[model samples]
Target: MPQKKLPRLRGMDNVREDEELEQFGDSASLFVRDAININFTSAGRAELRQEMKLATDQALRCLWQSPLHKDCFAALGSYWCKVDAETWQIEQLIECGPGDVFHIVLNNMICMACDEGLFVYDGSQAKRLTIDTPAKPNATDAGDGSLPASDYSLAISWVANGLESALSEIDQVSLSKNSSINLQFPMCLDPNVSHVRVYMTEPGGGELQQAIELNIATRSVMIANLPELGRAAQFQYLSPMKTGNFLREWRGRLWAVRSNVLYFSEAMSYHLTDERYNFIQFPQRIRFIEPVDGGIWVGLADHVAFLRGQDVRSMSIERKASRAPMYGSSTLLHSDMIKELSQGGTWCAVWLAENGFVSGTAEGQLVELQYKSIKGISAESCQLVGFADRLVSVVN
Candidate 1:
């Protein structure tokens, strides 16, 4: 035709954008965004523990309390300060309403809870903030059995600096006897987090639920009872359940263990189906459930059992006869279960037959008891308090 001009070549004629993209595939793109390479070996376990130790040390608050000191502290409900773990020296034993506490979060804000309201403690004074309570139509005793027409007032003084500008309401849920509050504020599920759950034990001696779901993004409140509410959305017990209790959540599913149990909601296929929970009764009374690598290690007075999925197989001791009997028919003793360590340290108590009892710490320290000697231990210095080996206090 008209001297078809040789196809005009662009300046960078050889450059192929699609070819470069194909060569740098998904793996390369993913590596640039988020990459995790795990090396699994014996070294990994020790490395994990070290990382965990560093994390805990940076996050936890360490305090020391003697028996007499604790009794006086509880009696007064006062707020006091103790030495940092690094310093190992106590300081600032101030007096408050015997219920005041210094809560350290993110290694910055130290908060104090007072009757007036939740207050921010700036290592010195308590600054109170106005908090909103649920609308009580009849003002029926305001949640904690107090005859007061209003709900329990919480005063917090220290709000993490930048967070203070955003702090809307901070409520302090009281702990029942032998119970604790496991609070997850700015929860893990929602990055722009808002809601706070109040999990508490029922005054009727079971479990109770009160959800304060406020969408920080939207600033709205939603409350639902656990039994009636589906478990698909985020849900946690107001109080930690006993070693053996069944729970049905919003998403249907079934999960059980001697220590904790759950029934999942049908909406969540990833979870167990919700239905009537069944408890497995052992021929002998179960004392404790300790989780190991792949299964649960069950403790019994006479022998130990390893449970994998559903099959329960007993682990025979090389010296079974040498182990002392911990429980008798219809009677259980305090020594039957393992002793829990205080100050977030790992320690377990085990019966050693003629050896009487042995307590070992994560650090490999051993406390042994015999008929004549209670060696390698100072009971007075122990920060652990428990009944029948059920941990009660982890005093620092």
Candidate 2:
């Protein structure tokens, strides 16, 4: 006697009832209501989800596990925390505004983004990168050295480690007689600021050149005979990076997003941005962004917009999807594991859409798997992580 074969359900389609699903009964199901804590095996069979719980009492909003970093990072109730990657020991890195923390690696360090602002974690604590510009230096006349004095323009920038703030307002000094210009720098209150850089125009010159770099403690300096001048002011009109929730390093530039606008840091300079030229505006809120080989994938409120090219100004943008993906739902596939699943396409940005799992490629190509499998699902925030050949999506 031949045993009756039961159909294997591949996905759920609540939009279609049993009568409507009869034609596809060998593939789909009309109901999947009680599948909590259950996962589908590779063979399309359901089983209990295998999970190992990490012990921690602090409510964590988000975590970034990085191969470049020895310690993992977490957002624990308005504080950034460092967790021992192996021992899971928790240590508060620093206090920040309460919100989800997003991360990216740039300048050989971990950059964290949250509601508060953009920050980078030094080994000791989280150091904030400032957007505030230094105030213009006060220009006055001191006795001359050798050259006759004309008009002078002075500006200053604050520096902390490798980061530099925006240039201050230009202060013009007019000298009727032969005199050296005495410039007084403003007092710096931020503890992260280490020194102040002064830029001045050579005796009547229009181009502001680097005059001197002084410790924040030294309040003023009198210039007599100018020593060898440094390079011209590069960021005279540039501003520091604005606050963004999602940040990624792509194509030698750091990209960040908040609300509906996407900002990219200036070329070669990772801390400054010219908003006029280094930003893109999406019609809707950006949910997620991922770096591809030559371009990036942007998940918006109801569509996936794929931007292709090396440069931001000339990149071609194309609309990929019409449905909303769960916020923060992007799971970056490992480079080697990309070939393990059916081996057809090298998928990078895989997200949980309203329909099912969709994999996008570096070439702006998209391949969908298990379409209509998990229908009518949405979440405010979903963290998708890949582990041990398994994709885990946690909805918060």
Candidate 3:
């Protein structure tokens, strides 16, 4: 005896019989499964595959119809859809609403809004919206209650894109896994705030890392550590001068140089392993640091140096020369005043400053950089993450 097949739904009693969809005429019958696996005969196997296909198609339609999904679909072209665990069988396609997608985890899924505004949403409800301004808000505008009254933004990272590709199963965006929710910001120029904050939390909204705060009144400098939430972190007070400067993490060290005073903490550990109460005592203000020859590259006013283990030495003795590419004699006047540096490719990248930008390679080769004309806009605040192919930055 042949196995029985599931019945197909009719499309308003089709007058043309040939136009009707076949439930079993083509390949096989279908069955749907949630998570559990079921053993079935060859006939059942065919049905399961068909059922999976139908489920996936229906889910995609729901995702596509969503207003939230359509708004910035291009920037989020990397976005993918999956069946909602609780509403898998719901026939109506999922529409983008308050709760369609909210969180983005590395290599997991990323939820983004179409417009350049703040979107507040609960799991299923959107609470409020605020549009972003073109220019940095002035001090007077900062006092106005235009921005959301959220303190967490001070220590957060503003990722414009590439967020959806960062999530992973170890930290997925489901209800059960150790998931975390981060509000995304494209730029950080709010007059009210000094700097953005970055924190890591657990599925239940518990903090996993402590908060890192940057100073907005200063240059583009930041500590590269995601605070360890819940842990009581202690720091040996090495009174770093409050020169209104910034701290940066490189090669696993919290590095801060104030008026020639070089202060360094162990990488990730944040422990004051070594401190030269005065950095100017060594040479010039350590301009920048990089990774070279399996060691750390330290840039000074006129030389490129290296540090490995505990030994620091100058690799190039060309003092008074800029470590970065120079377009003219004036760009080198402030070799220590590097505004921005980004990896361009496996071998090249561009730099930025108030005057203009330059380019460089991993092998210490540098060149003045230029951007191919895009509309009437010029690239600024540009940073290269992977190689030269994927440039992530915004233009003024």
TM-score of each: 0.24, 0.87, 0.25
The alpha-carbon deviation from the true structure for residue 331 of candidate 1, after best TM-score superposition, in angstroms, is 25
Best by TM-score: 2
Between prediction 1 and prediction 2, the one with superior lDDT is 2
Over 1-396, each residue of candidate 1 has an lDDT whose tens digit, in order, gives: 567322211111112343432223233321111112321232212112112234223222323232222311111224454444444333444444443232222123243323332333344543332122222111111233222221222211111222211121334443233232233333223232233333322333233333243334332222222223212222221111111211111112222233223112223221112233223345555443333223333435455444444222232222122232232111112332434334153323333322344443323233443333222221211123333323322211
CA RMSD of each candidate after superposition: 26.4, 3.5, 26.2
How does candidate 2 fare on TM-score?
A: 0.87
**Which residue runs does candidate 1 get wrong by more than 4 Å?**
1-193, 196-213, 216-289, 310-322, 325-351, 355-396
- Ranked by TM-score from best down, the candidates are 2, 3, 1
lDDT (tens digit, per residue) of candidate 2 on 59-81: 76677776675568998877888
RMSD, candidate 3, Å: 26.2
Q: Among all windows of ten consecutive residues in candidate 2, which has the lowest summed lDDT? A: 25-34
Best-performing candidate as measured by lDDT: 2
Better of 1 and 2 by TM-score: 2
lDDT of each: 0.29, 0.77, 0.31
The list of candidate 2 runs beyond 4 A from truth reads 1-34, 51-54, 85-88, 334-347
Query: If both were scored by lDDT, which would come out higher, candidate 1 or candidate 3?
Result: 3
